[model samples]
Target: MRLSRRLEKLPPYLFVEISRKIAEKRAQGIRVVSFAIGDPDLPTPPHILDALVEASRDPANHRYPETEGLPELRQAIARWYRRRFGVELDPDTEVLPLIGSKEGIGHVAFCLIDPGDIALVPDPGYPVYPMGTVLAGGEPYYLPLREENGFLPDLDEVPAEVARRAKVLWLNYPNNPTGAVADLDFFRRAVEFARRYDLAICHDGPYTEVAFDGYRPPSFLQAEGAKEVGIEFHSLSKSYNMTGWRIGMAVGNAELIRALRDVKSNLDSGIPQAIQLMAIAALDGPQDCIDEHNRVYQRRRDRLVEALRSLGLRVNPSPASLYLWARVPEGETSVSYTTKLLEEAAVVVTPGVGYGPSGEGYIRLSLTLPDDDLEEGLRRLEAIAHGRPVRL
Candidate 1:
């Protein structure tokens, strides 16, 4: 049997490698503490779960749902957007619920990019951006997200010809792996750039509600003219601890939403009706869970920041997102340091290079582990710092 060329071109998924390493260690009877993935350790709120239970029991919810989502869910999403970001959306044309934002993020490439087209993908970004473009047979033009530039891609540096040929500009904030946040001013500039280049902007914003220090992240759609040229993908995964529910939405340019909807309609079934109802509950119900979850993540971020600093690893304590990006200690590459921690401390952290070439010198630690595991991971790190042997 022959595999497709696209499958051959696809690089190994980052998290899959991390999981493999963890399984290998565990199979040897070594208990590992991992800060590798940005999945929330918290449970879904009771009210949201209750909504799912009730919806699941309804016979109507068992049938195939509309690919565009339930009208009530769409309206709820629009209402939430207006309340949260002051960005009004047309529920009928602008809001399209997703199985998860990842699904839309991947499928949007097919919607916008033809074979041999170009996508401006940020280096050190979520791997899905470039991978999706690749799967669609589009070339990815990597824009380095250097720390010196606040991790924002410098649009001016892109060659004129490359910009002209690019069909999509992929962005994320608060960003994955780096925990970098972008404001509306930057988003406005991005909108202008996209307009000039005639590119569609895809902003992955799953971490917006996961901010800390009372700092709220802005929606790309909140920028003037952003909705004219871009779409924002948001998920209930981080905010409502609903990752397992597989519910999310894309809101913005009606044309882009419709294109993505068309791709989705052909490729897969829509989000389960019960899950859509639960997502609606997440959107319209009390928002206090978001603040509560942020507080917990904030505490963990602080503790991890302190621990990493004491070990002489340079980390900028970010104001948002579920990760702390830290430069590895001098003389160690990301993979080497990651391997060292795994071997010596039974700790698993994601190597930054897994994100992109620009991520080579760093490692990313997620703030989504339980407090007990976090403390133990800290102890193990401290043990390594102090030149003491881990008990294994």
Candidate 2:
């Protein structure tokens, strides 16, 4: 049987290729120091685990769950949003749980995008944004996020005609790959742009709570009138180190939430009830755990940033998220530099080209590795800088 035309248009998934290469290296008995994926290496906190253990013992949780989400879980998310971002949400209408933020990010396009419609996506942003748009038979119009613009997309740069045709405008921050955070002023402008263009603003917010050095990234819903035109996705994957739990929430614009739920209802049975119960504990439980974790990430970030800088590479220090985006030497491609680091140093990193064309000269390194492994990777990087004829 022939594959669907949409499936045929898709390229091999980027992360799959990264993981394949890593597996190949490991097969050769190479202890590759991986900084590829954004997956947290930490375990879920005991409080959440304990909650899940207790909740799972109940037969009620073993059955099918509401596709919209658990009532308590939605309420817990609402309360968490109020306390964290000062954004109030109606648990019943404005919030929906996701298998993971990635699922929600990938599916939101199907809710709003029609065939041949446009999706405005950030260059060097999450791959899911454009891929999802393409899968839904929609066009992806890239909005370049250059370093000079503080790695934020400039609204004025987008052609007015493209914006008019766009059904979804996706934004993420404490952004992926780049680790750039967005401010309220930017969100306000983006909200206005989406409102004027009749686009659905989809904010992928997994890193909303993953910040450092007293930096607090604002939620898209916090911007004035954002709830009228946007939906923001949040995941326990990053903030709570519960990646495997497969639970997250999308909040804002009740209509958009309903649209996503309609699309999801046919495809998924909702997250497991036990996971939602555990998520309640994650949201309402002590947040000090996140703070402690961020402290570790901060230390890792500083050491990595310092290591990159000493090698004469230009890198903007990331104040949030678990990544450091560093520019490669002049005239070097991202794939070549990253491949060299992998081969010569046995240190695995993500090539910026994997993110998008605008990321051609950069590479992203994750801070998810343990301190000792990270230190060793840094030492290896330092050795390369000294012994090799690399462009620093």
Candidate 3:
């Protein structure tokens, strides 16, 4: 059988492949404690669920929903940005509801990129960024995000030849896999760079509200002139524990929004009306739930950081997101290190190389498990460090 050349060149997703291996091991009686996935473990708030229930019962919601989402949901998202970040948006044109930010990001690449076009992506960044570029028939020019640069890519280093052909640049603050948050100055510089290169900036901001300390993650649009060169993708998954609902939004240039919407219209009819109604509730309802959830996550983060450090692993406390990005000890490859941890300790973690090439020396441990599970995982990890076997 023959497959498209495009599909042939695409690499198998590392997470799915690793997860399958873990599942097979567990099937053979090996216990597994998975920390590889960054899925939020919290249940959806009752009010949001209740709203969905009520909406689902309404006879009017049985038909197709608006592709752009209900006006109420759009307005709610606009109000959210205005109130939280002081960045106002025209709900009608600037905000386009997405099934999830991942879909929006992927489709943006499909809509904007063509064969031979260049895309600037960060090394050690989200895997989807480069994969989506390839799926769209574009060439990716990786801008390495290294620890030496605080995990932020330097735009000045990109060659003029690549910059000239680059059509899109992807940015993610409170970044996935790294948990590195970008400051206002960094955003400003990014905006300037995008404008100079005449490229569209797709800013992925899912982890903004997952921040720790007193640090607040800034929206790309908050930067000077960001509106002209950037569109920001926001998700309800991490912020409101609405991951399963698959609701998110993209807000920015009207032209870009329209282009994305056009591509989406052909591929999807949009999420269910019930979900959009519930999303509106999520956006407008009291947000104290987020504060409470973050508090729980913070406690877990503290405990895990302490435990890992005590075991001689230098773990970096993530300021945002549900991940702990830690460096493996000397002489261990990322895949080998994570595999041993999973098999010996029953604690599954993400190999950093799964994110990108620059991630070779690290692993990402998700904090989505319950406190008891986290504590148990830590205990097992500690036992392994002390040269004792973890008996399941």
Candidate 4:
């Protein structure tokens, strides 16, 4: 069967490949401990679930929703930013509900980018960012994110020729896979760069509320002049343990929101009204839930980092997000290292090369397992490091 030329150009997802291997192991009856996917293991808070149940009973919820989103949800999202980041937003014009931030990330590319245009994307970044650009018929120019730059792309280093042709730039803080947080000064510089280059900045900020150790990740709009060139995506998936709920918001620049809404209206129907109600509950409710969630993740982060260090792998303690990015031992490619771990240790982790070429020789382990499961995974890793083999 022949696929569309556009679809054929896309790279297969490495995480999905890992998942297939996991499935094969499961088929063989192995109790494989998984640290590959960044999915929260915690259940959604009961109060938010109750809100969904209540909304589900309402007759109005059974109907199709507004593509732009429920007014109540948008207003709640707006209030969240104002309270947390001191960035005031017009709920009516600046906020658009997303199926999840991923959908917004993908569709926003199609909305803003034209064929043959260029987009500045971070290497070792979330796959969706660059993949979206490709699927939208735009060329992607990867800015290699290195430890020397603190894993943040240096906009000034991008050649002027590349900058002039770029229509969009995708950025994430408290980043996926790496867990590197960006500061306000960095965001200000990014906004300045975008304005100077006449490019739109899409800030994917799903992990802001999941930060630890007094680390507060700021909204891009908190930077001066950001509203003129930036749009930020937020999701309840990470902070509220609501990944399956599929509700998120894109807020900033009224023009960007309108373009997103117009594109969204053509693609599909809105998120379920019931889910929107629950998302509102998540935003407006007491944020003690966030604190508790962060506490759990912090414990796992500390435990995993210690465990990896014991296995002779140097891993930096993550300041935020659910991943521990660690380099594979000397003389092993990331793919070979991960394959050996899976087959011998019965432990699964994401190979860094799956993210991009710059990620070679590294691996990402997700701290999304229960305490017992995490300990067991670490034990398996230790055994593997000691040159012992285990049956899967």
Q: What TM-score goes with each of the models?
A: 0.99, 0.97, 0.98, 0.98
Clashes of 1: 0
The whole-model C-alpha lDDT of candidate 4 against the native structure comes to: 0.90
TM-score of model 4 (CA atoms): 0.98
Least lDDT summed over 10 consecutive residues: which range in candidate 1? 2-11
Q: 282-372, model 1: which lDDT tens digit per residue?
A: 8999989889999999999999998889988899898999999999988999999999999999899999999999999999999989999
The deviation in Å at residue 158 for candidate 1 is 0.2
Stretches of model 4 off by over 4 angstroms after superposition: none
Q: Write down the lDDT that model 2 would get.
A: 0.90
Candidate RMSDs in Å, in order, are 0.8, 2.0, 1.1, 1.0
Residue pairs clashing in model 3 are none
TM-score of 3: 0.98
Name the top lDDT candidate: 1
**Residue-level error in angstroms, candidate 4, position 322:** 0.9
Q: What is the C-alpha lDDT of each candidate?
A: 0.93, 0.90, 0.88, 0.90
- A best-first ranking of the candidates according to their lDDT comes to 1, 4, 2, 3
List where candidate 3 sits over 4 angstroms from the true fold. none
Off by over 4 Å in 1: none
Clashing pairs in 4: none
Tens digits of per-residue lDDT, candidate 2, 281-321, equal: 99999889999999989988888888889998898779999
Q: By the lDDT metric, which is better: model 1 or model 2?
A: 1
Alpha carbon lDDT of residue 362, candidate 2?
Answer: 93
